[model samples]
Target chain A: MKNSNENKFLSPGHNACAGCGQLSAAQAVMRGLNENIIIANATGCLEVTTTAYPQSAWGLPWIHSLFENAAAVASGILASLKQKGDKKTKVVVQAGDGGTFDIGLGLISGMWERGENILYICYDTEAYSNTGIQASGSTPYGASTTTTPDGSASIGSTQGKKDMLAIALAHGVKYVAQTTTGFPDDITNKVKKALSVEGPSYIQILCPCIPGWKINNDQAVMMGKSAVQTALYPLLEYSDGQLISSSLKKGFQARPAGEYLKNQGRFKHLKDKDISLIEKLAQANIDKYKI
Target chain B: MKNEKVSLITKPNTTLANKTGAWRTAKPMTDLLTCIGCSLCAKICPEGCIVMGEISESAANGKKLKPKNKKLKPKTDYNYCKGCGLCTHECLVKAIKMIKDY
Candidate 1:
């Protein structure tokens, strides 16, 4: 389907940055959702920008919950729908990486453990972008942020990104997928696939932040694509406990990780050693996924 | 004065009343002569302010016409466009230009 004009659920007049990858990804997510859907959006860039006081960009039935309670709010909504015998309606919780990997982990786990029928989407911008680009659980290693500034004797963040995908699998979610803004169709297809499953599902989309990543406004899409092509953030999918698909394939000549890092000012501080370290990390993913 | 409770709820679509055009430092001007009428700009616009509309005959006649096919050009709703320039960037023929808003 056409990306534009097909989905009017997420109207476009709000104040997201020009060429905001998250907003583009959100539009793709909307394409997969039907009319009988309700969204519980967590506090983040998406929530703050879309619902600025009296103005709202949401064309669907949506509720803004606290940063850590979107999953819980969705659970409650699902319960109410169940009580009303409304099986046709779907409940979706949309959160940022901070909400999913850190603040809301407990509640998300609780909802998943209860086996609620909900589709949870995490727009992983890699840092707490709304709060001025602070480090979050999903922030990559050696990346500069407000809190993890690269200085003398410092290479930005010291820790690796948290593997939230494994956490979802541990929670026994039936369907889980990871995609980036580079592939809009993949995101839409995965969301549709996740919603088709009977139990809880999860999708994490790598939405490159413009100001946070220190890239030009028009470079978000290109950065997202490079991220996948470099295998730094490979497109991935899992059904039940099995890996159904991964974009990283054997014999596929991977683009140098430096290509992905060089454009963004956030990674400008990286030295040869840091680039190799990131390359090693991507190689490790390739090995693990057998791609 | 009596203490009164205030309701935070406002009517839906109140956002529509807001004319965000004031936020533009640069404005996108579409050059119909260079435009291919591909609608890529309209498709990629983050703000759904761009719409494909019928091209006037006089305006079409002023340009070198591809006589076989009738095409629709995109028009911008400045009331909502924040002048993000996504459309200008996506335009293949360089039809859209971001000029000083004033």
Candidate 2:
């Protein structure tokens, strides 16, 4: 779409965390989209920020649904658009990790399985960020949350995040990618590319949340960049059943998952062995990608 | 204006966004992984500040994903940069910048 300031985009007054990665991601998305598209945000941070009753921050035709059913809502949007012959406008589903990785996983999978023509972007901050900093399915192992706090007995989030791109790829969809708030260009470029693609596309973003992870607000962006640079989150894409190119191929220095943990009070109680174990997690990521 | 080397993204209503630059300058960031080799960033650039040339063609996606190391190795036309971080913010992967230098 032609760039124009007059075209209404993200509305004002919606409360999002200052320097919020999701907002940055959302802004990047606006840059990629044509400005005429409608977004269906899940009942997470984005929805809460945009549709607070009388005051809404969204600049487009937006809908907010339950935590786990944004995909269904987007599907309905596509189906309704098709029924009305509204071909010019595209529909987008925006959800958080809680909505996508946890509660909404089944519906999201179903939507992709059906080859729904829409863009579903998951802002995976790795937890249920809006609701009291709880753990979600995507929460990394050993990172503490309200419920998964480090203690004498357990490693926080024992399992690793559900592999989203693989999940999307498994659905046999047209396009899928793993992205992060770390690189704005990478995020926008992918969004633009996905917009151009005709079939269903899933963009899984490794968004960082200050409060949820108990990280310093200033560290949010840096942490995002760290995740990608450290090989903890590799930037890759899959298309037509083939693994394509990767981003930042020069690769990055491996930072400690402890570095990611130290900033947040969540992992404050972690013992040295716990830190070492998390370090192993980081090493495993590097080994898996062979970086 | 003195710090030409840094990024500066103002709040809305001050400058240009992808759709709302009626009275401001908002630049875009390019997320490397998310970029799909579309020339939209270059095309949308009002001042040719974006060197789409840096976009890497990943060995994986033969025709997709642009040049790599854009952040550390970009050749921007700063006179044309306009202090609008539309390119930085527009990036799906969040790679562009309108920030002032530290």
Candidate 3:
């Protein structure tokens, strides 16, 4: 539809779930991008919903290849731009946590090793939402998924979420940041900052899934904010292997982890003791990242 | 490149043809009197259909207001709203409500 406030990058009418946190976070990401850019999207919910057959919601040049090769595709794009002597247009890679943490990790490491000036954004849904909510490397402990369903004997996923920021830092990425869909402005600003830096950068955004997290449509944003407030997934930024900013500052009082866990069906099976264990995890993050 | 060698690339914004409002079971209606012009709804809309618009004279007719301060309000494009109810839930002043679309 014709309107004054049409989103320049991502247009409306894509088939993403209503109030989808990933889509909303992507909206913010688009706001940070200028017209002179190309995006390499990995196979996931963002790629599937936006580019259907002969239709595309993206207003800019966008490409989708495979789940595990978006970084490679972005590298190729950067190489082509370099060969063409086109220094203006920037390259970016967008992938879900499945693609970033599990499938595309090797290729992403290779890209970072070369130190290509590309921004890699990971939409951390914590599970493979497009594949019917299967647990991935980013799935937090005590959260239920299709593969790690909670039952009489099992308490959902057994492992904790991977520290992707630290891994990105280990690769000597120039910029690394973490944000949630709750903070749209923060996501946009961080995207701008990452693009400003002239080397490999990584940004991971916590995007809640309605069906995967088993939350109400409106609860996605609330859950994202609660995740940060509970310090379960704190807002963080790193520069050249040094901590630049974080949410776990001295004055910050973390909300009880239970407030965030009890709101989602994925964590519904967690007991009081299990909740306490999760609390300890958040506490450890607090201690580890204390400023 | 010849036409026969063309790849299957699509045009930008061609997905606009798919009017997603048909998927909505509810409609968000806003009370302008209580709106504080925050535009949170416009920012959080997944469809990117909500926009901030100037309050028209008729829209502000019933409510008494200082003419010196004209406030902007969120206007949703129903053609793509999808009735997610996020705007209604996140409204700062509880001005938006989700009513049955039927």
Best-to-worst lDDT order: 3, 1, 2
Q: lDDT values of the candidates?
A: 0.85, 0.66, 0.92
lDDT by residue for model 3 (A119-192), tens? 99999999999999999999999889999999999999999999888889989999999999988889999999
* Residue pairs in clash, model 1: A249-A291, A250-A291
Candidate 3's TM-score on the B chain: 0.85
Better of 1 and 3 by lDDT: 3
How well is each residue in A126-233 modelled by candidate 1, as lDDT tens digits?
999999999999999999999999999899999999999999999899999999987777987999999889999999999999899999776777787899899899
TM-score of the A-chain for all models: 0.98, 0.90, 0.98
Best by TM-score: 3
Which segments of model 2 are wrong by more than 4 Å?
Answer: A1-7, A248-252, B1-102
Q: Using alpha carbons, what is the TM-score of model 3?
A: 0.96
Would you estimate the TM-scores of all the predictions?
0.89, 0.71, 0.96
Q: What are the candidates' individual DockQ scores?
A: 0.29, 0.04, 0.58
Candidate 2 lDDT tens digits, B3-76: 55532222332212222222234433444555554544443332333444444456235654335433222334
